[model samples]
Target: MRTQVAIIGSGPSGLLLGQLLTDAGIDNVILERATQDYVLGRIRAGVLEEGMAGMLDEAGAGARMRREGLPHDGFDLTFSARHHRIDLFGLTGKHVIVYGQTEVTRDLMDRRAQTGGVTVYEAANVQPRDFDGAQPYVTYEQDGIEHRLYCDFIAGCDGYHGPSRKAVEGRGLETFERVYPFGWLGIVADVPPVSHELIYSNHPRGFALCSMRSNTRSRYYVQCALDEKVEEWPDERFWDEIRRRLPTETAEKMTTGPSIEKSIAPLRSFVAEPMRFGRLFLVGDAAHIVPPTGAKGLNLAASDVRYLFDGVREHYAEKSDAGIDVYSQRALRRVWKAERFSWWMTNTMHCFPEQGAFGQRIQEAELDYLAGSVAASTSLAENYVGLPY
Candidate 1:
């Protein structure tokens, strides 16, 4: 098989990139080792920056999101049992849409199908080969048969654990990471949110976030020990714990119910340097990861796609390699900024056992300063809504 681009993994990044290429008259095919049902079953963050929303619109997949996604101009920051609103739109003139990542993937998948694009589910042992040379191709096994796919370029949107990143491991691939001491015990329930907008709370117990997937489906999380198990938290216990972390009034107003889904995810900030390796390029989680404190994961993926798509499109449309040549630098610049924000937010909201009371005091002072200073507040708002792509 031959195509202009061979995309590994059918996650949002891979699917979005393929869809963009197909619409631009570029041939591409997606290879996924997992079934379509398994792909959509994975739960992910829903916060969408204006930049990502625009990309979805550009790909002709924004109608459903525009109709169903919730847009927020601001969110509340809680500390000392007091709520302070960070006016994202008022401060930066931009707001984010609360749309589930799964929905985003679904929309992209639907659009791809409509456009007659190719995506192979359950493709086995997918591997990128000869990316360092002028010619690049992918190899995979399917239905107990082995095949090769030749392509002009390879997109490593296969994520951190996928073969794309591992393929170039010994070829000067440097990585950096910091794992937090805590994890978030999250639950999705069929209930209205406690507030119309999201609430990020800092408490002595830990950090908590009140978010939602839709008007009727609320998602909530509370910080837990890294070793904590899901079995330790029943629905009733989870509700009680989250309420205890919120302000009295907000907790009183919150509606509790039996959770439909539950999980615990450890927080980490990671980045792999130099996103491009010859004819192969990394997009999204393959290149970087954030702590999810500022909701930057999916947005960073969109940013990478923007750079790569522009570069790849230019290569064909104008016979230029300038964009692709600098994909790493451009994407890394934004990736580092987001990493910094996520790190800072995590430090500010989360309790560090080693830092003790001193850290607590410093965090209190930081939030208090933001509450009083327009400059500090605007900085937070700018990062929260997302910086320019």
Candidate 2:
């Protein structure tokens, strides 16, 4: 019925926050609307920025990642039939790990099960009640029964549509958002990746990415009309687009299997200001979201959890609320920086279908600037490598 902290949504943020609190000898409960299987099985982002990997490693949850995850020190940027590899480690002394979100969730859940440090209430509908009051509770329906979980504070780790965001809608929070005209059609194919390193291609056809989820399983994405449907893209059509963007000379032959999964995710950047409402704090997608271009969704969520854990630990450890008081403002500074980086990367690499010749020329000029100037290239590499946590 009561605890030191109650977390809504069992996504990365909530789960990681719970784990951190548990490690600090704090009691917390996590509520999720989806089944445990769904949360652990769903495919999501795979790129882990350098700092993110270090954080997970320090948290003692990087075992599986160390075994199966691919480590990349650089990625190729292709434009005008030229390939320029940004040496991530050489330029910034950083590296990224290619591990799917599914794997990260599984690792955390496994740790929770073994240590008994977290109470995961899955397959439940969670509603935030009395966030402004000293005593707040999360009411949820589980197995046809309603349960009210009261706690000292609530951490909203839920995604965009979760109940936590709407719970404080009347508090006059500032919202900033931008929706793109295109979406990415992403898929996981049962084949080896065409390239050893991730490739970001700028072609006349459109924007395409070549990445690997694992040694045998590969992930790929292509820009399409925002309203495009799955039914409109057949197997042949998908391969055709990949070939056009990758070009035969540089890309290996893709052996098509049954398209395992497909999704059309609209490109957008979103932020909700003042991520705190009384004792209910918002982190991760519940607070802000960046498009997949910069691969910041899961990493940002992890970073937010780190911040929240530090703040909450200080609050309880030292009998001081100073850390918790400034949590939102501190988190927002990093959030806005990521937002800008993601938006800039998306626009710079992806060409609009309706872009005129002048627009094309401008993009070319930008790429040229990045490629020609060591200063500009280093800046790109630093931002792409990631900022300190």
Candidate 3:
């Protein structure tokens, strides 16, 4: 088979890129190692940066999002039982939308189907071959048969564990990573949210977050030991632990119910330099990852897609390689900034195993200053709402 672009992954990054390129009259095919049902079944972050929300609209997949997603202007940060509001809109004139990544994937998948775009699901042994040369292609096995797909370019959107990043092995790509000692025990329930906006808390026990998917659906998380097992934490224990970490008033008024879904996610910050390798370009988790503290993972992916789409569009429309030539340099600049923010937020709110009493005092002082200083709050707001693409 032949196409203009071969995308290795059907996640949001690859799907979104395919949608944009197809809409622009570019031919592309997406390959996925998992079934569509399996892909959508995976739970992910819900907060959408302003820039990402806008990108969804551009791709014609924002109708359901715009109709159902909540617009949050600010969020609460609590320490020492005191709640401080960070005015996202008031400080930066921009706000984020509470739309689940799962919904985004669904919308993109539906759009692709409606447009008759090609996406091969359950592809096995998917690999990118000769991406460094002008004639790049992808190969995979399907239905017990091996198939080769030739394309003008390859997009590695398959994520960290996927083959796209591994294809560049021995190619001199520098990687940076830091894994936190703890994980987040998260649950999604049908209860109404504890608050209208998200609340991030630094309690004496650990760190907790109260977020929502809608007015009637709540998502909450509390820090846990890295090796904590889900079976060890039943619904009752999860609710109790989260409530104890919240402020007295909020906890008293909070609604508790049986959890619909539960899991523990480890926190980590990872990045691979030079997102582009010859005719292949890495997007989203394929190139970088961020701890979820600042809600930067999906947003960073959207930003990478934006840069890559522009480059690909310029190459086809104007017959110029100028945009594609610098894809890595531009994407990495923003990726590093987001990395710094996620790292800082994780450090500020979580209790570090290595940080002694002195570190606690320093964290308290930083939070105190953040609550009192307009400059500090604005800086947080700007990054929270997202920097310009």
Candidate 4:
């Protein structure tokens, strides 16, 4: 098979790119190593930055999101047994949409199907070949047959563990990574959320986040040791721990239920420099990863797709290489800012193992200042609403 672009990975990043390109009359195909059901089954963060919501609209996958996604102008931050609200919309004139990543993927996949775009699921041993040279192609095995896809360019939209990033090995690429000493034990339950908007709390024990996927489905997380296992946390124990971390009022109103999904996700901040090499471009987690503290992972992926789509569109529409030429620089600029924000959020909200009492005092002071000062609140609001694209 031959195409204009071959996108490796059918996650949101790859699928969004395919949708944009296909809508623009450019031909592309997506390849995934997992079945569609498995892909959608993975639970992920739901906070949607303003820019990401806009991109979904551009891809013609916004109707359901706009209809069902909850819009929030503010979120609560609890510290010192008090609740402080960050008026995101009031301070930044922008708001976020609380739409699950799963829903976003479904919308994009449905749109892709309706538009007649091709996505190959369960593709095995998928590899990008000859990306550095002009005639780039991808190879993979499917159903006992070896298949080759010739393309003008290859998009590595695969995640961190995927082959896309590794393909750039031996090339002059630098990587920066910091793995946190802790993880977040998250649970999804069928109960009304304790609060209307998300609440991020810092207590003597640990950090906790109260979030929701919908009106009746709550998603919550509590920081845990890196060595902690999901099996160690039963539903009752998880709820008890969550309540201990929240403010008294909020905790009193919280509803408890059997967890439908539970897992522990390690925290890490990783970035690969020069998101492009020859004809291959790294998009989303293939290029960078941020801790979920600030909810930047999925939004960063969408922004990367936006930058890449702009460059690709420019290349095809105007026969101009200028956009693609500067794609790496443009994308990296935004990537670094997000990395900094996510790192800062993690440091401020979580209790570091080595952060002695002095560090704890400083964290408390910072939170107090952030709650009392309009400037500090605005800064938080702006970053939470998302930096401009």
Candidate 5:
């Protein structure tokens, strides 16, 4: 098989990249190691940043989102029992859509399947070989048979652990990494959201977020110790912790049943240099990972694909590889910004006594300042709702 571009991983980044390329009259193939159902069912990031709704809508995948997606102009910042709302649209004229990556993936998949312009190879392994030369091949298996796919270029949207980055090992790529002392235990429930807007709570106990997916489905997150076991913090214990962090009036009537999904994700930050190695390029989580506090994971992926498509277009249209050439630097600017925001939000909201008495005081001061100053509150709200694109 041969294509102009071969995208690894069918996650949002890869799938959106393929769609962009297809829209531009470029042929591409997508390879994923997971079954289609698994990819579509995976529970992941749910917040779409300000400009993301517009970007995806223009890309021909926003019809369903426009029809049924939830929108919020701002979110609530809760400390103790007090709630302060920061109007994101009022402050920055931008607002986020409360939607899940799963739905985005499903919509893209449905459109791609119907158009028949994008070829998705599920349960396939893409091994990029001879990238330094003109033709690169991704070898994989299908229906118990081995096959080789040839493409002019490869997009390593496969994510942090996929083969794309491994293929670029020893290529002098600069890397940065940071792992926090805590992680988030997330849950998706079939309950109506307790608040009309999302609530980000900072309590002596830990950090908690109350966001919803739909009128009937809600999403929530709570900070947990790094080594906390899923078995130890069962549903009952989970709700107990949630109640402690939520606002008074909301918590009194809040109800949760068995979760449709639950999991713990380590809070960490990582970024790779250049976002490209010869004909292979990385986009989204493959190039960067942000702590979810800022709600940037999915938006960053979409932004990276925009850059990747522009680079590919430059290569074909202008006969210049400059766009692809600076892909990493361009994406990293926003990546690091979100990284800083995520780190700041995490450190500010969560109690970090382990860092020392000074650390605890600093966190408290941040909370106080955010609550006291309208300017500071607006800054935090704008970033939380999302910065520009």
Candidate 6:
């Protein structure tokens, strides 16, 4: 097999990249270790930055999102038992859309299929080879038959644990990571959200986020011990706990229902420097991960794709390597800023049992200042809407 680019994942990042490339008349193929159902089965938070939404529009996949996604001009931040609204659009002149990540991937997948792009699902042991030199290729197995895909370049969009990053180990690749002591215990239920907009609640109990996938379907989360289990959190207990964290009035309005999905995710900040490795480039989760506190996970991946797609386009259209040359530099500058924001938000909103009372008081002071100061609130609003590409 031969292609211009070989992508090693079928997740949102990989699918988005593949769609952009196909639209640009660049031939690309995707290789996935899992089936299509498995890729779409993974539910994720969907807070779309304007830039990311525009990319979907560019790829001809934004119709569904624009039709069904919820647009928000602002979100509420609750601390000290009071609610302060951060007017995202008022401060930054930009707003975000609440669309599930699964839906975005589905749209991209549908677009890819419509365009007749190739994706090899259930590919076994996919390996990227000879990326350090010109003319890189990939090898994988399917149905007991081995095959090789020759491509001009390789995109390591396979995510954190995928073979692309593993392939570059010990070759001057550096990684930085911070694993949080707690995780987010989240549940998805078909209940009307208490508020039209998201609420970030900071209580003595912990941090709780009241978010929704749509007007009728809600997704909620609360901070929990890293070792907490999903099975241990029955619907009734989970509902009671979240209610305790929210404001009294807001809690009274919240509707409760059985969760269709429940899971716990450890919060962490991780980055792999120098996203480029010769003919190979790491994209999205392959390069970095931010705690979901700031809702930057999928949006960050889109930003990475934006940089990489531009670089790749320049390489082909103008025969210039300039964009590709600085791909790592450009992506990391944005990545670090996002990491800082997520880290700061996480530290501010979450209760650190380790920090005791002093820390709690300090956090309350920070939240108080954020609510009272226009400059501080503007900063929060700006970051929440997303920093410019």
lDDT (Cα atoms) of all candidates against the true structure: 0.95, 0.84, 0.94, 0.94, 0.83, 0.95
> Which tens-of-lDDT digit does each residue in 1-389 have in candidate 3?
99999999999999999999999999999999999999999888979998999989999999999999999999999988889999999999999999999999999999999988999999999999998888999999998999999999899999989998999978988899999999999999999999999999987689999999889999999999998999999999998998999899999999999999999999999999878899999999999999999999999999999999999999999999999999999999999999999999999999989888888778878999999999999999999989888
Off by over 4 Å in 1: none
Worst 10 residues of 4 by lDDT: 355-364
lDDT of 5: 0.83
Q: What are the per-residue Cα lDDT tens digits for candidate 6 across 278-366?
A: 98999999999999999998999999999999999999999999999999999999999999999999999998868898899999999
Candidate 3: segments with Cα more than 4 A from true spot: none
Query: How many clashing pairs does model 4 include?
Result: 0
Which parts of model 5 have CA positions greater than 4 angstroms off? 356-358
The digit string of per-residue lDDT tens for model 5 on 108-173 reads: 887777767655556466688888788887888878788888999988988889888888878887
Candidate 1 local lDDT, residue 153: 95
What is the TM-score of candidate 3?
0.99
lDDT, candidate 2, 39-84, per-residue tens:
8778998799876777666667788898989989889888877778
Across residues 211-291, which tens digit of lDDT does each residue of candidate 4 receive? 999999999999999998898999999999999999888999999999999999999999999999999999999999999
Indicate the residue-level lDDT of 373 in model 2. 82
Error of 1 at 306 (Å): 0.3
Among residues 3 or more apart in sequence or in different chains, the pairs in candidate 6 whose N, CA or C atoms overlap within 3 Å are none
Per candidate, the number of residue pairs that clash is 0, 0, 0, 0, 0, 0
TM-score against truth, every candidate: 0.99, 0.96, 0.99, 0.99, 0.95, 0.99
What is the C-alpha lDDT profile of model 1 across 16-101, one tens digit per residue? 89989999999999999999999999999989999999999999999999999999999999999999999999999999999999
Question: Over 4 Å off in model 4, which ranges?
Answer: none
